[model samples]
Target: MDPSRVVLFKSLSKTLSPALGIGWIVAPPRWTQQLHRADQVDAQPSALDQLAFAELLESGAYDRHLRSCRQRYRLRRDTLVQALAKQLPDAPVSGVAAGLHLILRLPTAVDTRAVVTAAAARSLRVADLATYHATDDHADHGLVLGYGNLADSAVIEAVRHLRDAVEECG
Candidate 1:
């Protein structure tokens, strides 16, 4: 790929905080200059956010924080996976190796919407897999569960509740 044809976009919002909304672009000077000119009419990220981000980078705190986040999320993911494996042995899970969420596939006869409703009644939040699709509206029924903000200690209980919900609805 030609360097001139490629531009990289980076954002601190994803790694840092969404409220910060600090981001930058990497491109050839000509492209950058055009962006710079357009930028004059567009709003920029807050100076305070920029300064805070810079300080975190300069002090190496950003890297440390990211590493800490990775470890915490990994543990949470593992805990969720283990609990689900033991609790919902028949419900196949996927996309667990990365990201904050994973998919729990249900039986073909199970009603995905009903499961979502049942889970909500049990105080467990989950999404129907079909909603993520653009069409068919009838294939690959499952739940999209996020373990990101779930407490490590509560993982087992959550899975248990989810199992009850699945069994009840499925």
Candidate 2:
């Protein structure tokens, strides 16, 4: 890969706090001028915010926070995975290695919208995987299950209801 063709966009909002309002772009030297010009009106973080974040980094607090977040999210993710596996053993799940969300790919014979509707009827919540895609060309038949804010105790019950919904809609 050519270095000139690579550009990286990074933000701490998701990892840390969105209120910090800081992000950056790394592009080849020549491309930077154009990118800067195009986003001349973009908001910049305050000097105090920058100093505070730098202190968090320098004091190792940020790293500690990241470790804590990872442990917490990992446990939640594992709970959801286990529930899904036990309740829907044949469902194909992905993104288990990392992240706060996972994708449960349904069988081709399953009607995604019907499943969503049925889940809603059962007071279970699930999203159609296609809703996240820009177009049908790249969409998959599945559900996007997010466990970021789900209570650990409720995971199994949720999966049980989800399984019932899928079975009802399939």
Best by TM-score: 1
Q: Rate the local accuracy (lDDT) of all candidates.
A: 0.87, 0.87
Q: What is the lDDT of residue 98 in candidate 2?
A: 62
Candidate 1 residue-wise lDDT, 1-170, digit = tens: 57788888888776777777788888877797688877763667778878988999999999999999999999889888888888888888999987899999988778889989999999999999999988985668799999887888888899998998888987
- Superposed by TM-score, candidate 1 places the C-alpha of residue 36 at a distance from the truth, in angstroms, of 2.0
